[model samples]
Target chain A: MMTVIYIVYSAVCFAVAAALLVVALHRACKARIAARSERLLAQRYVRMITALLISDEGAPMSRFAFCGRRGAKSVLARALASVSRSTCGDGCGVVRRIMAANGVEGWLLGRARRSRGYGRARYLSMLASLPVSVSTANFVGRYAGSRNRHIRFWAMMVRVVADPAAALYVLSTYPHRFTAYETAAITAVLRRGLLPLACYPLLTSPSHNLKALGLNIVRMFGMADAERFLMDIISDDADRDDVREAIFAVAAMHLPVTRGEIVARVRGMSLSERRSLCRRLACEGYSASVIMRLAANRDRHYMETLVASYKRSLVCCG
Target chain B: MRQVLIVGDSGVPRDMVAAAAECAGCAVVCVDDMAQAAADCKRGRFDRVVVIGSAPFFDGRMSVGQLRPCGLQRPELYVIGWHQSEHTVLGLLEFGVNQYIAFPVNLRRLCRKIGAPIFRGI
Candidate 1:
């Protein structure tokens, strides 16, 4: 009985090892094949895209039409997206034409619709880079109200790209506050073009996040025309984050904030706010006297530390 | 054939730039290492060297500042997130950059900057 048990155990162990080895070999082979195919696709895409860009005729478009074939759509989409991202002006127009010729939009929309969860979100996010079209917007708009926040976020991005003029409106109505990642993504989109003329509404929105976004847009775009709106926010009782953003925007744009205005704002602000304003003003090359005025009745040690740090930074930069 | 060298890590679309340069009738070489790029530039083989500013070169080991001294001819600084700031422009100019091309790069302009004939259909 003991001998039989030992033989059975050895047989079981050998069988398990053999199965594991087969699985490992299969996986390695699959990976190698995938890598090889990917390399070939990359080489083909380089040749095709370069020829397309160099050729004066539309012959390359028909060549790119093979993107509709099985397994090639994703690779083609990725290659074209890379090309589109690295180019602007007439080059971008050329890429757009290629995408159109290849039916990339329809493939992406179909994939996004069929996919679930993260897969769906991935496809939607990819759509953000493509040129805006009515059909794409209509499809993406259905998901703007999705329960999944990721999908909703990407859907909103597509909508924003589809109609940039209504960006503020789309963002202000979002059910949740914009996360840092979301803010950065939206900022990237806005960076591609001038901020819409209707951005003023974001400042006056009830949501603190929207107000913060507005302040950031103002700072980034150097919208000096919004100085009056920023002044009102500084003086009014607003969210601390909004106030901080407003001050930073004011300092960044170098919009003339009078000493009287600063003093008045300081009077209504908390000690921390006063400290932040002083530090920002000092960094922006404001006079020491003005910084001292802002620092009045606050911790002298903190003020000294801030001034010392600022001087150290200036020296380091120089 | 004009030669162009692109120095950037994975964050940059080096392959795309290479393809564009190739289409514009130039031989393109891409390297992720600053040392290798400096070495290539030292040979004076490349007509233009494009340094991507988006890569993480902050360790003080190698930087554009170091690469500028490699006797590079027509070094173009290509930076993403390019804001219209005079200070930033002047800073790049001080780095011995002959051109500051912001993303998304105008391929036609890039070809002209690199002394290559712009493609007819590009």
Candidate 2:
């Protein structure tokens, strides 16, 4: 019994020591790899940045060549990203030209095709940051309908880059409404001076969510003509939710629309939407006639929102 | 050496951040979820906490909310992701997150933020 116990203890000690040795070896290897990459990164990064600024495509590619094709691609990827963030206007155009000159577009397309789901998503994101090209845009569009949310999200960004109007259309009709990321991405794209006037027609879209998105786009872009679009949509029998969104947008923007036009549309809207509109109108300091009319409707929740807004306005005005 | 607590699933970005942290002469402890990160914050002393967002966090399905109560003593919170919105960025800032970095990971900015002087030129 004593001999058996001694043998078991020795085996356990050996096993633990082996595991520790493996861990130490693995960490050392990782450390070495990191040190090597950091050294390579330090040597190559500044040269690439300088070459990109000059728009001399050959210089960046040649500088990257010192790192070999694979290493060069990694370095260029970082440089491309840095340039994308730090510069804009024709400078961005220069960076894109340099990227194209480096064969990044083709390499990205190949990466997109050959990589698995996550790899493909990463490449799609990289492609989105580049200037839109026919092949990259086409490749991204094919994945816009992908069931994987990551692929769809990145594809939408690429779509927004390649064609904002078409992307807006896709968002309007997409079965799934915009996720927060999608909303932010679309907002960012539209804020990049993409015209909102073109998306006004979508206010009449059959999807209520799409209409809301249209209203948001209009609001974010501050298309003043959109007031006419909003009034027209509400004047017709439109989704109460969408009308609420427009009113919210209007109030958020502090844009003035005819209060009478809004009051006229309220009879057809839901109590909740009417309440929201009342709150907005009150907050925007619209005429008392409209506020009193909605306040008189007497749904308790609706009344509370309006009354709260009215009271807050009084506090401000008083 | 600076000690960083990285909160996120195991992935390329996480690994990159960890490697970067190490290269900066900092020690890294990685936890796969917020709960683990919270627990580590109680038990560990860290100089920075980097909440690396994966596709899920960027999708708005997940968040690293309110880091102040996590027992971290003066650790700056940095978020790294791809394509986070201004609203999200502002929200993170408001919630006491120190920085939100939208990727392809900016090594110079990242190294600088972590006090990693190894990048040299930046």
Candidate 3:
């Protein structure tokens, strides 16, 4: 019985060691295979995609064959997607041709419909990098409220880029408030002043965040074109948050387009309202005298800290 | 051939780095283990150094402090990863990195950023 017990213990030990060895060997093999595939992908598909992007060449037979292969197709898809955003002129034409040749565009659209979670996110990200179309934009717009934050953000990005006014409309009307990161991503696209004229209606949105977003975008794009609507929004007894956003817009406008109207309104404002405007002006680096005078009127202690904050901002920003 | 040093331990796929560098007409020298990257720095200079993976940017092992002691100089440094906050990207700037290409490196942006002049069909 003692011999039998010893034998059993030895067998258990041997099995455990052998299992560990097999796992280690399997991992090593996988790593080696991955490395080899990467080398092949880099040498074969990456350069071809790059060449197609840089030149006006049509999709070659090589790309068509690569799409049929297992490892090569994924490599081709990812590499093509990577360059899609920057492509323009003939660059876009060539990439589209390559995708057509490989049937990648159809595969992407098909996979986009079937996927969920990361798979869907990846497909959407790839789709965003492609040139815009009504169908693709609508497909992305469908996920604007995806339970997955990543999917939602990327979808919002696609929609916002495709049509800012509509996206912002949906964003404002929806109960969801985009996280700061999502807001920044959407804003970056609109920051360049490409907003459609339809943004005017959103300024009156019942949603505070949406109204604030519209005010900020109008301010950022210098849509002095919206000065009339802005004047109305500023004068209206709008949400305090919306009013604060208007104060920021007034500050951003600087010289007299709407500055006179803003100054006239400021004289009738409350202390808290004055404080909010002064804080925004300070942050936006409006002329120091304006903020300093307001700070002094608020309180001596507030003035001292406000002055210090301005000094720090100047030192850091400069 | 133009050479670049890529330091990371978090298993960022090797193909991504190689494709980016090669597309820009450079070759990549990947150092999988951060300690080994520090050791390798002593051997020679690289045209560019890319740091990726893990948190706090390059972590303590692959920080500039370790690389500088080994006499590496003037190689353009880049930090690439998924950044949770702008503060972390700003913190890396304090370390003298040349650029921070966040994760899902925009290939065209990366090419333009590195001054490759390959896109624009130019």
For candidate 3, give the DockQ: 0.08
TM-score of chain B of each: 0.69, 0.78, 0.75
Task: Give one digit per residue, the lDDT tens place, for model 1 in B39-92.
Answer: 877676565677666333433355565555554444444443345455555666
Q: Which candidate is the best by DockQ?
A: 1
> What do the candidate models score in CA lDDT, each in turn?
0.69, 0.63, 0.62
Sorted by TM-score (best first), the order is 1, 3, 2
Q: Candidate 1, overall lDDT?
A: 0.69
**Between the candidate structures 1 and 3, which one is better when assessed by lDDT?**
1
* TM-scores of the candidates in the order shown: 0.76, 0.51, 0.53
lDDT of 3 at A122: 86
Candidate 2 lDDT over residue span A165-235, tens digit each: 57656565666766646665555545434424357666777776567667777765556667777777766
C-alpha DockQ of every model: 0.38, 0.04, 0.08
Tens-place lDDT per residue, model 1, A1-318, is 999999999999999999999999999999999878865685577556644654436444554634556678887776766655455554445555777777788888999999998888888887876665766987789998888888999998888777777766777788887776787667665555523634688788788767877777787667888988888787774576677677778878776555566567666777777777777877777656656766757465677777778787776655
Model 3, which residues run further than 4 Å from truth? A1-4, A7-11, A28-47, A57-66, A69-72, A87-90, A132-232, A237-246, A249-283, A286-310, A313-318, B1-122
Q: Highest TM-score, which number? A: 1
Q: After superposition, how far is residue A97 of candidate 1 from its true place, in Å?
A: 3.4
Q: What is the total number of backbone clashes in candidate 3? A: 0
Ranking by lDDT: 1, 2, 3
lDDT of 2 at B112: 57
Candidate 2 error regions (>4 Å): A1-4, A7-11, A14-18, A21-51, A54-87, A116-119, A149-183, A193-214, A221-225, A256-318, B1-122
Query: Alpha carbon lDDT of residue A149, candidate 3?
Result: 78
